[model samples]
Target: MSDKETPEQRRERLRQEEIKNNIGGNLNDSINKSNNGNLVDLVGSLGWKGTGILIIVIILGYIIYSLFFS
Candidate 1:
């Protein structure tokens, strides 16, 4: 902010400040995107407990669908 700062430096500093201010939103987006990766990565990230729950839900859904519609 000093008068001694060059224009390019000022621009770069402003850009960095803006990026810092926006980092919280970016972090949340990154976490959400991480879960949306390929199937294997998503499952691995969730670990065994999450994988078990996901499989249980799928099996229950299939059972209900077969009973009701087929």
Candidate 2:
């Protein structure tokens, strides 16, 4: 593989490195903390439509795994 990076590649590498080195503040704050910290309502915060799509994708993944391995 070629080892040399273009200008864009160098800039992106530095940007990612900066993000990696910075770790402070409420970066650890949970997004699903509303609804009195209830797991069900936290997921519901994604909206009914988004939650449905997430469930469908998870089911599809399980189906694909079973088809190939079973």
Candidate 3:
């Protein structure tokens, strides 16, 4: 993260970052398979009515925040 890092240090940092990302991706894939596809599974469990209400609430919250802050 520092500008003073040598090339070897940067390379090793990137290698570690890639390893972490690969492990995270594998874990995410396993979880998605078990949970039946992440957001799709969530919306399905909520059903149409619950999903609609969620969207409405999110939109209203955004609008209220914008009105007050911006």
TM-score of 2: 0.42
Candidate 2 positional error at 19, Å: 26
lDDT of each: 0.66, 0.55, 0.65
Which stretches of model 1 miss by more than 4 angstroms? Answer: 1-36
Clashing residue pairs for model 1: none
lDDT of 1 at 36: 68
**Residue-wise C-alpha lDDT for candidate 2, range 1-70, written one tens digit per residue:** 1379888888767754553454221122223355246656445344444456668988999999999999
Residue 41 lDDT in model 2?
Answer: 48
- Per-residue error for 6 in candidate 3, Å, reads 61
Give the Cα RMSD of candidate 1: 11.7
Best by TM-score: 1
What is the TM-score of each predicted model, taking all chains together?
0.49, 0.42, 0.46
Off by over 4 Å in 3: 1-37
Give the alpha carbon lDDT tens digit for every residue of 6-64 in model 3. 99999878855654456545344544554756766545444455457768989999999
Using lDDT as the measure, which candidate wins? Answer: 1
